[model samples]
Structures are given as C-alpha cells and as structure tokens.
Target: MQETLTRLTFPLSTTSAPCSEEEFVARFNQRPGKEARMGYDCPLCRNKEFVLRVENGFHRPYACRCVTIRQNLTRLRNRGLLELYERCTFENYHVTEEWQRGARDCALSFQKSPLDGWFFISGPSGCGKTHLCTAIASQLILSGHDVQIHRWVEWAAQAKAAVTDSGAYAALVQPLKDCEVLYLDDFLKVQHGTRPTAADIRLAFEVLDTRYNTPDKPVLLSSELSLRQIAALDEALAGRIAERSRNHAVQIGSAPGRNYRFK
Candidate 1:
C-alpha cells in the first residue's frame, strides 16, 4: 500500500469546471481497448510493480485509475453535503422574478470570489433564497472546501435538546462555528404570524456570534424575513450579520406577489 501510494500521481485539487452527470460519466468511462494494453500505462498508477502485489498467494490490485477516481470523489463527498448532493448548483437555479435575477448574479459573483465576505439572502417564502444559498454552497464544496449546510429549524431542535445538556448542543453546532463555509438556511423559520421566541433568538445569537468573532469563515444565509425584520427581531445578532455582509448582501421580496412557491 505504501509503495502504491508513493507511486500514485494525480492532481489532488478539484479545480475543473463542474460537469453534467452525463458528461462526467462519459469523460471517465472512455477506457482503452484490452488488446492495446501492451504499451499502455495508467496515468495515476504508472503501470509499474506498485500497481499490484501478492499477499500470501492472493493477487491484490493496488494503485489504479479507479482508486484515484474514488479518492477524488471521497474528498468531494466529505464536505458534508448529504441533503444537497443534487439540484444545488448555479446551473440548476432559475431566475424568474427581477429580485431573483439579481440574487442569482450576486450568488454567482460570490461563488467566483468568495473572499468578499458573508452573503445574506432574505425575503418571503418560496423566493429562491434557499436555492441561491445552496448554489453558492455547492460551488464552495466543489472547489474543495469544508462546508456545512445547517437548517435553522433543525438546529433550533438541537438547541431545544441542549437545554439540559450543553455538551450535546456544542457537539451539534460546533461545525457551524468552524467550517470553511456555513450556509444557514431558513434562518429563524418560525411558524407563520409569529416571531421567534427569546430562546430561538439566543440560539441564533450564539452561532452568529461565534462565526463573527472568528473571521474569514464566509456565511451564506437565507431567511423568509427581510434584513430589517431580522434586525427588528434581534438588533445585536442582525448587526453582526449585517456588518459582515456589507455590499455582498442580497435581499429579495417585500410584499405578497414576490412569493414564488405557488408558481
């Protein structure tokens, strides 16, 4: 295994442009014919002695193209994108309303140059806020960064469970505090006609405060409430999010027609 690993040669970084599922399969599926194997060599395994070994009479294959491909795939999957593996990309997102178009542009810009800082997308329900945030998160993950996509309600549930066990809550939410990119979806998504309770606000404050104090971890946040509404809910927390967002923030809907869920 050590010899195989030492003989492997492939770009570990993921910088290639994103490809469609069909394109990806086609690119990797084109294998050389078996009859042409005499002079052929594996790009990653080098077709050398390290490519195979005999382990107690059993012929074991070591380094190969398949292993290299698996290693690359494992890195991408390790980004913690369980719920967002598909349909969470810039190409998958569609812009219908004027605000959604602007939001799409802003999301693409952030994907291209993420160092611009925290990106906040706020609006009414079904306004493509989550879609935009997911698109950005997908880009970051593909670019080889550790990213966490936390749902606000799910996280609040953890906070509820943590009322007695502080350690449990910390274990659940610590990834949000330290990931390379954190996408907090449906921020403060409380029931309709009711605002978040004091406990809810406190939970949000803790997470946002941790990220705010520890700089450079770009946050991609989306909510059914506008920035002003978030500020009205909790001034200090909103202030921290706003300060980091700066010009990168993109707000969507204001009134009823902006809701795109029905469409």
Candidate 2:
C-alpha cells in the first residue's frame, strides 16, 4: 500500500523512483492532466518538465532559477525600496544653480554611504527641503537600502498615540526603529499655527534620543525651521542632533525668480 501510495503521488519517469504499476494507473486516473501531458522529467536531470512539491501544492513545472530572480526583483520594486528617483518628481524641484549642485552632491553622498550619519535640511518654507530629502531617500533606496518617509506631524501624532495605546504605537515605532533610513519631512517646531507644545517637545526628544543616542542610526530631517529656531524649539534635542550629524545642518533658500518646489 505504501509503495502504491508513493507511485500514486509522484509521476513516473526514468529518473523517478520505482513504484507498482497499479499505483501508476491509479495516479493517471486521479490526475486528469498527468497522462495526456508529457510525464514528469526533471528539467535539470532531463530536458522535460518535472513535478516538484512546492509549499502550496504540486507544481508540474521544472524549477527555473530565473523565476526566483524575477520574483525577488518584483518584490523589491513593489516594496518601493527601489526606483526611488521615480517615486519623487525631480523636475518639479526648484532651486538655484548652486543649491541644486549641493543637493546633487548630498544625494550622491547618501547613495554611497547611507549609514554615515544624520542629515538635517533646514530653511524657510518653499525652499524644497522635502523635495531634496525625498530625492535623497529615493537614491538610497535604489542603492538597495530600506527607506521610510514620513511627515513630521504624522510621526508626532503616532508617537503621542503610542504613549497611550502601546499596540498602535508599536506599529509606528517598530518601523521607525527598524528602517535603514528614516526621512522626516517638514520637521519643525510648530503644528497648526501653534508653537511646539510640551508633549511635542517630549515626543521629539524621545525619538531623536532613541535614534541618535542608542543604536545611532542615520535620520534625515527636512524642515522649514532654521538651525537657531530648531535649537530654540528643544535645546537638548537640537544639541544632540547637531552633535551627532555629519553636516551639522543644510540651509535651503530661494533665489530671486525661482519658484518654490515645497509649496
């Protein structure tokens, strides 16, 4: 019975294991397409298709390395971790010739070494802080690193919720903690026309403290706040970020006749 069962489950081939002739007949009857179609023969072992039991079920297709490679490429692209430049619209980014050069240089630097240190882009509103940061993120992702982009306000809200609702909070926190590169878009001291509240200050401090002082991963902050203004928002947090970052700060400003890309 065991011998018959084995033959019934697997197709017979020259390279295939031996089984009772009755089992082969039973399997041929049970599997509608087994007989009419070419019998299972290992592609690697022979030039024909073979039956392989994959996780889901029996596949009457020979294993091809190309399938695995294609699947991996599809997964990487779908994850939005590749094709970073395509994700952000670059032609829409407006900046002066000099600032554009600087932005390109920063992007190249990040592409080469995404784990270097924190990057803080700060300046007045409409100066393309977020655009440049997004560009950097896109470049890093194309280079095969995991990247996360978030708005400052959105992150603040999640952190606040995490304080009270641990589960919901962990959903946000775990990603931030695990991501290879984190981009905080429009980071600043105010939200909804109000100055940074006590809670806001605490939340910012906790995130920066954990990321900068603990495992010491790189973070990117795009903000309209100037360096001095940032320092004023939370002196300790600003000080720590400044001390830990490589470039200290990046100031993006507008040149006359240039349209702002961040608006």
Candidate 3:
C-alpha cells in the first residue's frame, strides 16, 4: 500500500520535511477546489489533510499535523482573533517577576486541560492579563475549540442595548452562555475604576451562571477587580467565579514592578 500510494501521489518530493505555508501556496497557482486534494505543494498526506496508516492489518485515517495549522487559522479568522492570536503567543509572553510566571502557568494549565475548570487573572493594566488570556484563546483554537474573546465592557454595552428586545438580546448574549470557551476580559470593569452597577452585576450573573452550572464547559477571565473586590459587590457571582477558578486563579497586586507599564 505504501508503494502504491507513493506511486500514485503527484508532484510530491522525496524529502520528508513539510513545506512552509508560504512555500505551499507558492507551489499552486490557485487554491485547490472546495475539497482538498493530493496537490503539488504538500508532501505530507498530499493535501488531503489526513493520512492513512497501517493499523491492525488495515489502514486507518489519521489527521496530519498540517490539519491543526489549518484549523487554527480558520477558527481564529472566523472569530476575528487571528491577529491577536498570532501576536500574543505563550512563547512571546514576557515574565519578569515570580508572580507573573505563576500567572502564565495558570493560563497554560487551563489551555492544556480546558475541561478541567475555569481560569482567572485579575491585575492592573499593563500586567499582561490580556496577553495570557489571548494565549489561552490561541491554544484553545489550535486544539479545535471555539473560543469567544469577550471584551466585557463592549459586550455588556451591546447586551444592554438589546435588553428591551428579547429576540435581539438572546441573539447577542446566548452564544456566550453556551460557547465552548468564553474569555471575559475586564469583567465588571468600570471606566473610572468605580464599582459595577447593579445592572452590570446582574448581566454577569446571567451569563456566568450558565457556565457555572455546566462544569464541562470552562471559562477564562481577566479583570482589574480581584475576586475579593467582586465578592464585595455581589457575593453570588464572585463566589461562583472563585469556586470555578479556585485551582487556576492568580491575582497580581499593584506592588512595585508588578505593573509593566512604567517600564
């Protein structure tokens, strides 16, 4: 079968190394048909996105490494997070302090085992909270999970606008309640650093409670307010967040060197 496949495949090279994405595109004048094919550029799996391997005296289809790349790109693009995903990778995340390193570890843990539980990081601006959350979103995308990057301030505004229209409200907010992964950045964050209003607290409970009841679907959050601060405003919402993120929560203080903005 190996010999048969080798003989049938066209325009594939002898080298085992795969072509870079740029090189692959350069090899073809136009994108292949809607369906994948054994095109000229891809030597690994010949562009079928999966390869057949001998197993139990039969051949089984196994996903190629390249499939992961394509999936990540597609999902990121669809969710409008491609640029951020490319930029805020775990590899490029800077860690200058011990607490920062711990925060990164928490994000990595959640990214690796998303079904495990929720992850939270609360810190001042320029503390790399969004970067870590973006890192998690990228990894979740790479691992074939749909991630919703919820900029909480903007999201809340949209939800608030649609509140009077039941259909529009559900259209705007229902996805967050049931998304595979929801990364809420700046949860309950007020512009002047004031506490959230009763409405903000209620909106948070409406969305968060759904995820709270469904433990299998995990969440990621970054906020300027720490869990304790959130508890002071509304203990029920904060308690659920604290319990879910118990294992993977890290709060970076405003102590000297904690805020990278000064540097």
* Number of the top-ranking candidate, with TM-score as the measure: 3
Error of 3 at 119 (Å): 0.4
Cα lDDT, model 2, residue 239 = 84
Measured by lDDT, the strongest candidate is 3
> Candidate 3: where is the Cα deviation over 4 Å?
1-80, 257-263
State which candidate, 2 or 3, has the greater TM-score: 3
lDDT of each: 0.68, 0.59, 0.75
Q: Which regions in candidate 2 have their CA more than 4 angstroms from the true location?
A: 1-95, 253-263
Clash count, predicted structure 1: 0
Q: Arrange candidates, best lDDT first.
A: 3, 1, 2
What TM-score, over all chains together, does every model reach?
0.67, 0.60, 0.72
Across 89-114, the per-residue lDDT of candidate 1 in tens digits comes to 77877776666667788778778888
Q: Considering lDDT, which of the candidate structures 1 and 2 is the better prediction for this target?
A: 1
Q: Model 3 — which ten-residue stretch has the worst lDDT?
A: 31-40
Q: Give a tens-digit lDDT track for model 3, residues 1-263.
A: 45665553443343233764345434432334235522123456556565554444333445555565565566567768677778999999987777777788778877888888898888888889999998888777656576677789898989998899999999988989988888888888877946688889889999999889986878888898888889999999989988888788888889785632110
The per-prediction CA RMSD against the true structure, in angstroms, equals 11.1, 12.0, 8.8
Candidate 1 segments whose C-alpha is farther than 4 A from its true place: 1-84, 255-263
